[model samples]
Target: MQLIQLNLKHCRAAQDLLMQTVRERGSEVAILSEPYRTGNSQGWATDRTGKAALWLCGIGAQQMCDIKAADGFVRANVCGTWLYSCYLASSLSLESFGRILDELSIDLRGHCNAVVGGDFNAWAIE
Candidate 1:
C-alpha cells in the first residue's frame, strides 16, 4: 500500500538511488516520471510511450489499462485497488492537463478505490 513518486529528470544515478530508497523503505510500489531508460529496467513496468513507469517490489499487479503518453497515464490493479501513474509535461498548457484529467476520469469511472500518483509539472502559482 505504500507508494512513492518521483521525477527523476532522466538521470541514471537518480534511478539507482530511487531503487535503493524504495527497498529500504519497504515500499510496495514506486511511481516514476521522466525515468532514465537505457534499455528495459529490470523491475520497472515500461511502456512504448515512456513517459511514466511503475515498479512493484514484491506485490503482483494486473494491468487494467494500457500506458499511453497521449494521456500520460498507466493503470494497474493492485490488491483490489486501482493504481495509476501519470506524468504531465511542463511544456503543456493547463488546458491540456485538464483534458488529460478528464480522459483519466473516464478511465476511472467504475473504480471507487483508486490511487493516482505522478509528477505533474503544471501548477497555478500565478
Candidate 2:
C-alpha cells in the first residue's frame, strides 16, 4: 500500500498539487495537513462532501476506510493497519508533543501495524 504525506497550506492550489501527486504516485492513503479552508486555522476542515477537498479529488467516499479526525490528528483503520496523521504546530513545545505521543502509544497498544505520518514543523531534527 502506498501512503503519501503533505502539508497543503489550506489552499485550493495546494490541494490540487496533492491530487496530482496522488495520481502520479498512485497513493492509497494520503496524510494531508492544512487542507483547504476559509477561516479557522485552529482546526481541520473535513471535506464535507465525504470525498475531495476544495478542488482536489479524493480517494472517493466509497473507497475510504473507517476514518476519524480530532483536534491535532486524523486516523483511519484499513485492513488491520492503522494510519495516524498528525500535525503539530511550530509553537507547540516538544514536551507537549511527547505527551501527545505517549497518549497515542497507549491507544495503539494492540495494533500490529501502523503508519504514522505528518508535518512536525515544531521539531528541529538534528
Candidate 3:
C-alpha cells in the first residue's frame, strides 16, 4: 500500500498536487496534514477511479473501527489495526505535549497494531 504524507500549508493548489501525487505514485492512502478544508472534506475519501476511499476522522463509520477526531488527531480502525493521522502543534508546551501523549495512550488501549502518521514539524538540519 502506498501512503503519501503531505503538508498543504492550507493552499488550494495543494489539493491538485495531492491528486497528482496519487496518480503518479499510485498511492492507495493519503495522510494529509494542514489540508485546506474550506467546506467539509468528507468527499475526499474517494479517488477518481473509485478504487480507494479516505476514512477521515469523525466523518463517518469506517470498516471495523469507529473513527474518532480530536484537536490534533484523527484515528480509525482497519480490521484490528488502529491508524492515526495527527498534527502536532509547534508551540505546544512540555506539559501540554505530555498530556497529549497520555491521552493518545489511553486511546490506543486494547489495540495491538497501531500506525501514526503526519507532519510532526521536526526539521532536520543539514
Give the top-scoring candidate (lDDT): 1
- Ranking by TM-score, best first? 1, 3, 2
Write model 2 residue lDDT over 1-126, tens digit each, in one string.
Answer: 676777777679877777688788777666666666432322223332222221113353323355555545656665567777676677777787787667667766886788777666765679
Q: State each model's C-alpha RMSD to the native.
A: 3.1, 6.1, 7.3
Better of 1 and 3 by lDDT: 1
Candidate 1 clashing pairs, residues 3+ apart or interchain = none
For each candidate, the alpha-carbon lDDT, in order, equals: 0.74, 0.59, 0.59
Worst-scoring 10-residue span by lDDT in model 2: 48-57
What is candidate 1's lDDT per residue for 1-126, written digit by digit as tens?
Answer: 788888888999998998788788878877888888633544456534687777776444533343333467777766677777788888887788889889888988998898888887876879
Candidate 1 lDDT for residue 101: 81
Q: Which stretches of candidate 3 lie over 4 Å from their true place?
A: 38-65, 122-126
- TM-scores of the models, in the given order? 0.78, 0.67, 0.68
Model 2 lDDT, residue 111, Cα: 68
Error of 1 at 52 (Å): 1.3
Specify the poorest-scoring 10-residue window by lDDT in model 1: 61-70
